[model samples]
Target chain A: MAKSGHRTPRTALTCALSLAHGLPIGWCVLPITHFPFLLVSSAYNGCKRIHKEGKVMTFRSLYHTEVINDAGLNGHARVTLGGDFDVLTSSPLQDDPGTNPEQLLGLALATCLNATIEAEEGRRGLEHAAEVKVGVDMGKDTEGYQFFLDCQVRIPQVAEAEAQEILAKCERRCPVAKIVGSSQNVRVHLVKQFAF
Target chain B: MAKSGHRTPRTALTCALSLAHGLPIGWCVLPITHFPFLLVSSAYNGCKRIHKEGKVMTFRSLYHTEVINDAGLNGHARVTLGGDFDVLTSSPLQDDPGTNPEQLLGLALATCLNATIEAEEGRRGLEHAAEVKVGVDMGKDTEGYQFFLDCQVRIPQVAEAEAQEILAKCERRCPVAKIVGSSQNVRVHLVKQFAF
Candidate 1:
């Protein structure tokens, strides 16, 4: 174990060399002292540079789906961060009890939109309750198949103008919204309801 | 209740009028006769045309999320066709138990890929057990945040060449893959593992 008080000119030189050559450096610190080591791998350096520039943090998520039968239409999938979920297809004319891709997109958009609203409220230090409902419709047009999203947000305490402002912010800041909106000209209808 | 064997000129005229002017047609069958009425609305007319042309059937799904707290980060969401699921963000550096946008993307991709593979296999009349694992990584580049997907598909009882062919078909047909891939050049690495 390396001690923090042992960081002399030699230690600084070693750290610099490690960073320069793209190597991993490990440093051990004592209870009373703080020592920083340069585990400057190439990837680590890139991430560090990004962080130093005040960029958004990188996030990774994993998901696995095990097909239960020869028919791939049904499966069980679990996100490393989320619990297990089922995915299946159903006839448009029938009332089925399984999840489909359109539903996933709707769920994703609703949750992400709520998160964006929460983040804005947190920034403004406001305590207002809100609810979001997303309806996704799949249809075929000149561009084969496409989706339309209808998002209804109910804010009980915020005024209509302020709620509109918040929704505008979300439209610009929400990642899922940006991705889906820009892809294939998805028409998004926004309904803002003031319960108060 | 409409009766069958009532295919008179009046019934044909009614059907023609419904199809010509775009109306909602509801068909009913009686104990003694089965009568079909054309309740085809404008949208239903378009769908019927598409179906007559042998196009893919369209699917629609709805989702709702109610934010329980003033903070928008936590919420319960459910899909009309899918089961209930939770969506929440966690610190990027810590291993907290919450689902984020990235995880949802991964799950969606995995499920979509499996469904595509199943469609291809069904077309080819091949029966093989397959499982798919999708890993999505969100990183900041010069253009902001983008996603990278690594899909590992394990297929038993299929030859490598055939499996590759199936995967290629899936890559072309999977809607989620195409959407995410075309959005920002999402790098999708396909790995075929044979567990013989």
Candidate 2:
């Protein structure tokens, strides 16, 4: 693949950032990047496009979240957008009384996969009975410390093949999954019961 | 690149998982993946290879965390390993009173980068004065609903060039940064002050 083959098309990124910062789309001074996939696949408003002519663009985010961490691993992380949430972070190696990266990564994937599966269940008119568990291991590698995420999805009363299909779909559609799955360090398993 | 070029070499992954599960290295039934890089740079003991002769191995995870979610988006995510942590999960698109993928992803990066920067500060004998904030926007794209993460790093009492160097280092060293940064959809910025 050419270096240009994977440059993130800038359309949706520009649109989302502009709308989040309360700037008009046309007012964005960033260099225009024309990636057509971001142009065609976006159903945000199902409209033509974000015109650069200072016309009011219909682009907007379905959800926006902002968070800040000042204390690093031994400090607090709180929600600055969306809702009230805060977590105390500590290094697991120290046995400190707080969460750490491994925990956060696990929760991010577990919640994301289970939630996306729930949405899939809703569309199929099935009651939500799916469970997801993500296990993260932090260890030193040839390079440095790295993480490996092992995901297990369990959907009750569903046949194995169908559950696998749902898990596959969630792997594709869940945003967090899409992010982490891009790495080779992650895996998803279908299980009848969580090892925990 | 051949498809095998990117297959997750299984050395550290296997070692970590095996040690986590209390299984001996020789007893592991999984396929052996010999990624040479994982075989080399790992300073995890600066020792010899993991022999399959049922020998006692020195490999182990520095830290491990497991999390589970049963209720999906409208439920809860809690830690099952290391320390105790739990939080409500809700879809941001619904005005629900809880956390979601966006918040978790933000916290994951914010906490990871800031924590890693703190380590860097300690190494340089500087007081920890680094801060990180991540803003995530969720919108539909040609592919489907996607997330854009804008990371801002602020290092107080440091020159711009030096801080930029640190930020660039953290982008490469931080585990979460490595995972997410591999994608073109993410951007890291060094800023004088956070917009928020």
Candidate 3:
């Protein structure tokens, strides 16, 4: 990681100021051309590819969310990114047309895992249709609230053994799965319905 | 916790079968009425409250997501819960209409933290207007991809010191904050706009 050791004193100062002002430390902008000596490594290959396009690449992501009125019970969250996404804290049994944290986590996990699997298939020159279902359970124990995740990946037209191998690789490569699984427990299942 | 040690042989068998079948191990439904000897503790208060409505409660949330095409560049995900959400891997510099994982994590974190704050205020019998903004940064390091979170909370009509006190308590109680903060580094800032 050449980038890890390439932090200049000016960048350190900027980060300190940002922290003091309660701003994002990673939001500090610097012209990449000025640091021509900084070597790109395979670890940051994605970022390096983006930077090679004459663009100053910063991997930082910014997010904004506002809760409407009160919180919990009847309140809703209006999340603004490219559009407004409404999130509700209502239970799934409430017959409400709103989303929850568990749903969002499930979505993130499922999508990331599927993306990894698709990438693996592409690398292997294999084509298959795949779908993922994620189930998240939120509960409390002596250690306070915790999350249990169940992920099932169905890939038709692929051999069951091959699908299992691909899914295992995806589980190891998926970023969201790594994050959540490292922090908590996540169970992954690979199902092959029929062979084409 | 009594429930920790109350796993009956039947429940254990069911869990083993479910695991073998690639089903959710926690989805085993057992009638609570039959387990009168299992003592409820403070750790299970929240679960007990939800279960006291004379309904069998299962804290399971299921989600489905499909990858429309390949992974990474030019790829999109269709996530379906109660509603359909389209997520893209569009860069922030692009004027694209798509949501990303960072935004979703920010929404979940902001909402959960605000809910904890509201609950804390309710317990204290305090009424005040509050708003929270959560900023999450996704980047790569020597340890691979990671997240950095910055949360700023504004509470109106409350003393600065008192609001800080309450916000600190909220930080301690918020589940999402705990999950993320414990895993990574999270910076929390409590800002008081005006003196009331």
Best by TM-score: 2
**lDDT of every predicted structure (CA atoms):** 0.44, 0.66, 0.49
A111 Cα displacement, candidate 3 (Å)? 2.0
Q: What is the per-residue lDDT of model 2 for residues A174-195, given as tens digits with 9 covering 90 to 100? A: 8888777867567676888775
Binned by DockQ into CAPRI classes (incorrect, acceptable, medium, high), candidate 3 is incorrect
Off by over 4 Å in 1: A1-71, A80-96, A140-147, A152-164, A193-196, B1-71, B80-98, B139-148, B152-164, B193-196
lDDT of 3 by residue, B1-196 (tens): 0001011122243334224545444332234575444333111311211122222223322221222222442346544334454555443234455555555566666766776777777778877467777544455433234444456688765789888888877766665655555443355666553110
- What TM-score does each model's chain B reach against the true chain B? 0.54, 0.69, 0.53
Better of 1 and 3 by DockQ: 3
Candidate 1 or 2, higher DockQ? 2
Q: For model 2, which pairs clash? A: A41-B142, A141-B42, A142-B41, A142-B42
Model 1 chain B poorest 10 in a row by lDDT: B1-10
List model 1 lDDT by residue over B1-196, tens digit each. 0111101122333323234434433221122211223222122222211111112222221121121212344434554322343344432323444455555555666666776677667677877466667544444333223434445676555888877777776766676665565543243433454210
For model 1, what is the alpha-carbon lDDT of residue A83? 38
Which runs in model 3 stand beyond 4 Å of their true positions? A1-73, A80-93, A142-145, A155-165, A192-196, B1-94, B141-146, B160-165, B185-196
Higher-ranked by lDDT: 1 or 2: 2
